[model samples]
Each structure stands twice: as C-alpha cells, then as structure tokens.
Target: MRKHQSAGSAHGLPFSPPRHSQCGCAPARTERCGGLRRSTEPPPSSRARSLRRPQTVDAPSAPGGGRTGGRLKAVAVALAVLASVLAGPVEGADWQAAVKLNAGFTTMSGITHRGTLGTGERIGIDIDGEIERHRTEDVTAGVGASLGRRFGPWLLEAEYVWRYRTDWDATAPTPTIQAITNVFTNVRTSTLMLNAGRTGPFSARWLWEAGLGAGAVWNRMRSDYIERAVSGVRPERRFKRADTKTSLAWNLFAGISRAVGQRWRLGLRYRYIDLGELRAGPFEARPARLFANQGAHELQLALTLK
Candidate 1:
C-alpha cells in the first residue's frame, strides 16, 4: 500500500484545522450551543474600569429648601398681613365712614319785616325813612360725619353736621311818632342739619359731590332803642327787647374734592340755605318777622375709612 500522507499534508493547508471543545462546540461559535456567549473583548484598562463603576453624584440644594423654606413662607405671610393693615379696605369695598371739618364764609340776605307797629304796642321801634332791614356776612366753622355705601362709581351718603354760632349787628329807625328813634339789634344763630348726597369721581383722584339737607336753626335777637326828643315834645325814651326763635331750615350744596391720601380728601363747596322765618312775637300775631336766607362758600378736609 502507498504510504498515507498526513491529513494536514494531504490538504496542502498552511495550518492544521483546530479541534472542537469537549462540548462539541468551537470556541468562537460557542453561543450556538445554547448558553450565553462568552465575551471575546480584551479585558478593560484601569481608567475604563473606574468609569464603568456605578457613579454616586450629589444633588444640588434648592435656594430655600428645608428649614430655610419654612422661614421664607412665614416671612411672606407676615408681609401680606402688613400690607393689608397699612392700606385699609381696598377700593372695591362697598361701605365707608367719614368725618369732616369745614370753614365757611357766609353771606346773609337781610331780613324782611311785616305787620304794623301799634301805639305804645311798640316791640323794638325804628323810624329811619320807613325802611327796616338786618343783614350779615360772617365766617363760620362746622364739623360733620357720614356713613355711605358705594354702587359702581357712585357713592351715596347720609350725613349730620353742626355749625357753630354766628353773630350780626344791625341798626334801624323806630316808628315812634313822638320822637326820632333808633334801634340797634344783635343777632346770633346756630344750625344743625341732616343731609343726603351722591358723590362720583371725575378724574383719577378728584370727585364731585352734591347734596340736599333739612334741619333746624336757632336764632336769638336782642334790640335796644334810643329815642331823641325832636322839638323836645317827648322825654327821650330807651327800651330793650329780646327774642329767641327756632325755625325749619333747608339747604343745597355742591362740591369738588381731591384725594389727599388713601383715606383723606380736601374739598371746596358752595351752599344755599334758608332758615325759615323769625318772629318778634308769638306765631299767631307777630309785630315783625325776619327772613333768613344765606349762601356759603366752604373749605373742607375729610377723612374716610372703610
């Protein structure tokens, strides 16, 4: 028999074929055997191993976290309460209360006298060209308070006011036929009124107001007469008379105001008032009567709270 060439030499291959593992699988194809494939990659370097290790990063802290967050919340709540307290009620509130102080310049239309003076029935007498009159111009001060409700841009209020006393002096001729006589009168007046009004805004910080009022006025008058004998026919006579009267009164007013602060305002107003009639004697039969009608210009400062 011919000598059998070695298998490798017979194939004329450069190298011998590799043998299979005992498991019957080639090393490079071991995954086909049904188990996980072994990695053929080279072992990792030191730096690579460090990068692959599980990382533990620290998280960033919040600006005001933990106890600091609690303190911040408390501070925010305190600021809110302070703002409310300092500002008072907001603009949308419907109810308000106010107080005002006023100074006024008043002009009075002179009194009108009616009914004839009888002989010796003379109440105070005057005989200056058959004309009798009493008039006054004065400066007066007053105070007022009000409660109001708002509807849209309109505000309606009910107010009460007290005006201090005012005084006037007048001179007239007496009607006594026997002697040339002169009468001097002193008058004082005080007033109390209740008013209702509506106020509306005209500009960003300005408002207009109008009102009607009804109330009472008290008037006190004192008269002194001096008589001179004309032709020395009658002895000079001097006499005095005093009277007090309470009368029904009414008024109308209009004003414009500018806000001074959150709760205060400054205003200027004009008013027309009528204080009924004043009688020298009782109502049924009076020797004389005086009509008191007046006009006033006022400066007012007010405070309102809601």
Candidate 2:
C-alpha cells in the first residue's frame, strides 16, 4: 500500500503550530498573528475607571428638538414667575379688593372754537368771528372698583372707574356779529388703570399711602352751540354735535386709612387725574369745532375687604 501523506507535506509546504504573542495570547487565524493579545499595560485603577466619561450612542432626534425644547423650558419658567407675581402678594402678605365712591371737581381749560359761524348757503349768510377763551368748573362723582396685592409696604393694583355725566357752559360775544355765542357740553368719562404705590404708618389708628397710575380714558362728549341775536337784526342759529374719544390718562393720589375690622378698611383718598382732551365735531350749518383740555381733583371714600 502507498504511504498516506499530509496535505501540506504533499504540497511541499511546512506546517507549524499556532504562534503565541509575548503577552501569551494565541494567533486567531493562519494569516493574522497575535491579534488577540492581552495588553502589556497594567489594568486600570478603580479611580481611573470612575473618572472616565461614559460613552453614549446618539439617539434619533424629534421635530423641533434641542434649541426649541430649551426655549420652551425658559418660557415656561418665565410665565410661572409672572403668574405668581400677578396672582397675589409675597408670603404672609395681603390681597385686597375695594369698592370706592368718588366725589370731585373737574376743571376745564383751553376751551376754544374755530371755523365758520352761520347757515352756509341755505340762509345765504356766513360770518367769521374771534370768540373769547373760556374756562369752567363742575362737580364730578364716580364709582370704582380695585383689585390689588400688598407686599409689605408696597402695593400694586388694577382699577376701573366711571364718572357720571357733567355739564359745562360758556358764553361770549362774537366780535363780528351782534350775537352771543353759547357752548353747552356734556361729558361722561371712564378709566382703567394700573397703580403702584407704598403705604406706611401715620398714626396708631391710621395709615398713609401715596401712589401713581397710568391708563386709558374714554371720554364721550355731547356739545351744542347757539348764536343768539343780541340785536334782532340776526336770527338765532343752533347746531348740535356728539363724539367719543379715547386718550391716555394718568393720576397721582394720596390717602389715609383706618382698619374697620379684621377684613375691612375705610380710607379717604385724593387723586388728581389728567383726563386728556374733550373734542366735538364740526357741526352742520355752524361748521365749528370745539376742544377743551380737561382734568379732575377727586376725593374718594373707599371701603376695602382685605
């Protein structure tokens, strides 16, 4: 029988045992040498392992991720702070609501009129005249409500007030005509304001406070003018107009208060408010416009439930 030969020997190639690395690891395959070798360096210490940062795989991102999420979180934090501020006072402080009755006087200034005076075309007559400036004063009264929060001696409030209708009148002789020009104006006003102020001890029984406020005022004015004949030569001409205007308003106020009960307080406040301007149209026939700068000094008796 023929002698059996190994494949490598038959091919005239030498076959050797698998080689080992200097670190005592074996080669994994015929072509690769010592690829599975253990590291020659010593093992990492526990402290070193603890200090190494953890490796993390990247995760798929959602729509509007990263920056958007950060912005949303910031906004949420801001709104929470604002809500807490507006909802009430700081810890161990008071939140109050008040109903107030105000009685005061309003002064009218810069009252003037301009444009033509007469029934144009139909009466076949028109006259121009320089009317004298007029100023008037009237009594005013109003009712109001306020909601506020008190932080120590500081207070913040939102208030709404409505004043009843008041009338003003002025008459002057027309320079160019034998007529007395009379202007009658009826005014009604309402305001909404935000106020900030401080209160401190005045006496054992009374507390003193002062504040400033700014807001919008809605003024409704109804106005009419009459040119009555001082001499019978000219006929009486009457014109009517009505208008509403919104303007910026502001006030300064000071007050004194006394505690009525555990949850009640009675106060008297004086406020000086700029009511902006009163304006009325250029009426038909008379074709004249009216303007007045208006302001008020108000004394208010407020009953508050704290």
Candidate 3:
C-alpha cells in the first residue's frame, strides 16, 4: 500500500506533516483515511455577505456642517442691526417735558387819531396834539411763559406774554378856543400763541433755536383831555376808556441757549411781532380808533427747564 500522506505539504510524509494546516490544525490531526486535508474554516452562510458590506457614519455639526446652521446665524445678526436703527437718536435724550420763563423789553409803534369830534359850536373837539401825531416808542417791560413737549430737534409750545402799560401825553394851543388843552393816551397789550421751533447744536456749550408763532392779541386803551381857559375859566376834564379788543397777531424769533446745569438752560432771544390793528374809544359820541398797524421789538432773557 502507498504511504499515507497529509494534505498540508506538497510532498506526502509517512509521519505527520511538519507544517500545520491553513485551517489551524496539525496535519496528523486532520488527515483522513485517504490522507485528505479537512478545511478549518466553516462554509459561508446566507448573511455572511451582508456582514462584510461597507458602513456609513454621520459627521457632527462643525466646520463642514450643512448651510442651514450658517443661514440661521446670519439672520440673527441682521435682526440686531435693524433694531438699533429703528430706536433713533432722541431715544437717549431726556427732553420729554419742557418749560420756559422769560422777561423782556418791548418797543411799540405810536398811535394817530384819524377822526373828528363835533362839539355844539362852543369849542370844536379836535385831535391836535403831539400825542396824536408822534410815535410812542418806549422801552416797555414784559413777562412771558411757555409750556411744551420736545420731539427730537423740534418743539411745539403754548405761550403767553403780558406787556405793561405804555402812555403818552401832549399839550397844544387851538385857535379861537382860549384854553390850555392837554391830551393823554395809554395802551397795554397781551398775547396768546401757538409756537413751533427747531433746535440745533452750535458750539460745544451752545444750542441755536428758531421759531414762528401765530395767535391773538388783546389791546386796552384810555384817553383823557383837559381844557383850561386863559382868562380865569374853570378847567373841564374829560376822560374816556374803551373795551379791550382782540386781533390776529404773529411773531418770529431766534435765540442761542447755553446749558446751565444738567436739566436747565439760559438764553438770549430777539423777536419781531405784528400786533394787529387795535381800536378803542368813542367817548360821548366822539368816535376814535386809538391804535392801528402796531408792531413791537422785543429783547428777552429766557430760562428753560427740561
């Protein structure tokens, strides 16, 4: 009989093969009666191919993540910038409530008499005096106040001003009437207005402001006359007072303000106003309009509270 040989080696050996079989067993242990080598690996099952297939792994959201995360971050930044723009510059300023007081001098136009008075033939009453012909410009005193709200650089205010009485006296001689004649005229004015203004930065510590206003004016007038005969005649005095009249008026003004403290300011202002035609007396059927085409120049010192 031929010598038994193990399948692990090319040459068949009578004793066990020197090398082990590829299936991890010694050739002598695996050899059958015909000296055939038995495989150490088992036969493949149906699921074997599926187990050796490639596997996929998902990556974390980092540098190379999807564009969805990047888009979300960009939208957040845009919303922040939009919120800042809508807030506006005045949002940080503390100028919600404002009040102002002012004291000033007012110079006004004089009055002229344009009518005649007939007096029953003894002595005709006439307007013949310096008081009726000359301009009554005087340095009249005044006081005023304003209350309002400030909106950014703009202001809307309600204002009131009082002007003290201004008077003029004159004496003249009339032909055919032997008497010393004198005339006295006086007037006072007040105003109520709605004003609008704008404020702007000037220098480091100064702010410039300008405004325009329109409203009604009140004018009150009184007139008195005295007649004394040169030849020991009794002196007769006549006086007349008229009811106050309201007329349309308007003004324009400008000023520069300096900050005094954290919540106060002081300013110097110049103003021009047209106090419309004011008419006053008709004493004993002697009708006369005392004032017409009136105007005033005002210089004021103003204090503002914020």
Candidate 4:
C-alpha cells in the first residue's frame, strides 16, 4: 500500500501526512477518507507571533560556576596587590617602642653683663669694675629623647630634652687690676625640658613648653685679687674673697621644630631667663648677676623613642 501527501499553502509549511491501517489490505478506490476540504490557515496575528519568536537554547555551565567564580577572581587580585605593598617600605610610618639616636648643632644667645669686682665705687682704683655689656655667640650641640603617639592630626609626645651648651665668653673693664683684663673662657650648661608640639603641612612644627632647668657653669677669670703690697720683700698673700657660687636657675620657653625624619627632629627655641645671680670666688668677691630677657635662645636636636 502507498500513501500520498500533496502539501499546499492550506496548512502552511512543514505539514505532512501518513495513512495508517491495522489490516494488511488496502481500502477500495471508491472509499475516500477526507479529501480536499476548506482551507485551514492560522490567523495573521498567530503567524506574525511565530515569525517574531526566537528559538530557545539552554546555556552551557562553566566548570568553575556562576557569579561566585568572578567574585573569587576579583578577591585574588586585591590580595596580590596588598601583598606587594606589604613587602615594600613606607616613609614617615608609625613605629611603637623603638630605640633612637640624634645629634646636631646648637647655639646660645643672650646679653652677658660683667658686674663689679670690688665694693667701693670710688677708690685708689679709678673706677670699680662696671657692669659692661657684651654679646656671646658660639657653636653648640646636644642629644635628647622623646616618645609619641598619633591622635588624628595631633602628634602627642612626652619628651625629655637633655641639651648641652658650650663656649661661654666674657670681658669686663676691671679696676681691681690696673690693666684692661682680657677675659677668655668656656662654659658647659645643661637643661631637661618637656615639650608638646604639632606639625603642619605647610608650616614648620611648633612646640611650647614650661619646665624647670638647672645648669652648672664654670667661669675662668684672668685677673687675681690685689693684696696690700706692704714690703716688697713679703709674698702676695691669699684674700678671703670669692668670684663663684652655686646658683639656682629658672626659665620659660617657646620653640619651633623641624622633622628631619620619622625618628629625628631639630628645634630652635627662644626663652626669657631669670638666672637670678651667680657668684665666682676669686676674681669676683661679690655676687655676679646674670639676666636675660626675650633675647635668650637655644637650639637642640631630639631622637624619637616611639
């Protein structure tokens, strides 16, 4: 038995037919099964929808899978960058509890006055030693320590500045000795100070402090005491007089500092000193007074401990 499928536009494309029979025998030619009938065409809307619709395909799954894989890749990159940064050194970084050292030049400035050597204003000596005015400037150096913690924009530090000053000079017109006394000398002075300061981006660091400072000064004078030259044969005897005394000193200070590195700073300060009075035994039988106004200045270098 044979079957025929005469396809036409009546049912559109892709339409086919197959005849089926259970028995092995075919029906007679006169027996017709539903021949040419009314044209069955889908509506214009349905046809247009079928044309507009796209074929669907299932997407392939990646081996590593979904958004989780992309996220992991991003995380890995970030970690690599972080590791590189950690392997490198950073400047001006904070370090807690570290030992440090520093040394630099310094200078001391003030008005040095030479006081009287004798009690009498008028005597056989034309004039008792006058309080002569002179200026002292020299090279100095010191070493100190400090500890700090950063708080926002403020750097809070507790510091102990142990500074030393050398090269003290003085000259006075003396009546105790008939000749002009050419005085040349040196002094070593020390101070312990506490400072609190701030560093700005454009301006230098500023530090203001108030603390007690004590110093030991040694003064060397050229002239010796005059003895009553009674008989030229008698030797010059010792006089019961002094030119030196252990004195008490005090000061108030304001300063500015420059940070040379993470652990070092160089500072310059201006202070008003009230050293009160000092006494030297031999050349000065009386009290020798020292006074300094705003003209007093000090330069120091410091090491950061933490």
Model 4 lDDT at residue 44: 65
lDDT of prediction 3:
0.60
Encode model 2's per-residue lDDT on 226-270: one tens digit a residue. Answer: 888656588888888888876667899999999986889899999
TM-score of each: 0.50, 0.65, 0.58, 0.38
Give the least accurate 10-residue stretch of model 4, judged by summed lDDT.
Answer: 214-223
Q: Residue 140 error for model 4, in Å?
A: 1.2
Model 1 lDDT per residue over 1-306, tens place:
122234787678664434555544323322223575655434457535644667799864323346544544554464455335434664664776778887777766655443333243444543432434456677878787766656555555555566675554333454545555454455555555555577888999998988876665666777655565666567776666777765556778888878877866667667777654443422222233334455566666677775
lDDT of each: 0.58, 0.75, 0.60, 0.39
**Model 4 agreement with the true structure over 229-295: per-residue lDDT tens digits:** 3354444333333232222234454455566566555555555433222222333543433322211
Across 1-306, the per-residue lDDT of candidate 3 in tens digits comes to 224455644555345544444544333233355676664334456335534676789842223234534543553454344335434454544343333343444444455444332222334564333233445455567778876656788866667788877664545544335555555667688887767789999987799989988776777767675555455655565656655666667899998989987878888878888776655555554353344457777776878887
Q: Where in model 3 is the C-alpha error above 4 Å?
A: 1-110, 117-132, 168-173, 179-181, 285-289
C-alpha positional error of residue 62 in candidate 3 after TM-score superposition, expressed in Å: 89
Q: In candidate 2, which residue ranges exceed 4 Å CA deviation?
A: 1-85, 88-90, 114-128, 175-177, 230-232
Listed per candidate, the RMSD to the true structure in angstroms reads 42.7, 28.3, 42.4, 41.4
Per candidate, the number of residue pairs that clash is 7, 0, 0, 11
In candidate 3, residue 189 scores what lDDT?
Answer: 83
lDDT of residue 1 for candidate 2: 20
Candidate no. 1 TM-score = 0.50
Better of 1 and 2 by TM-score: 2
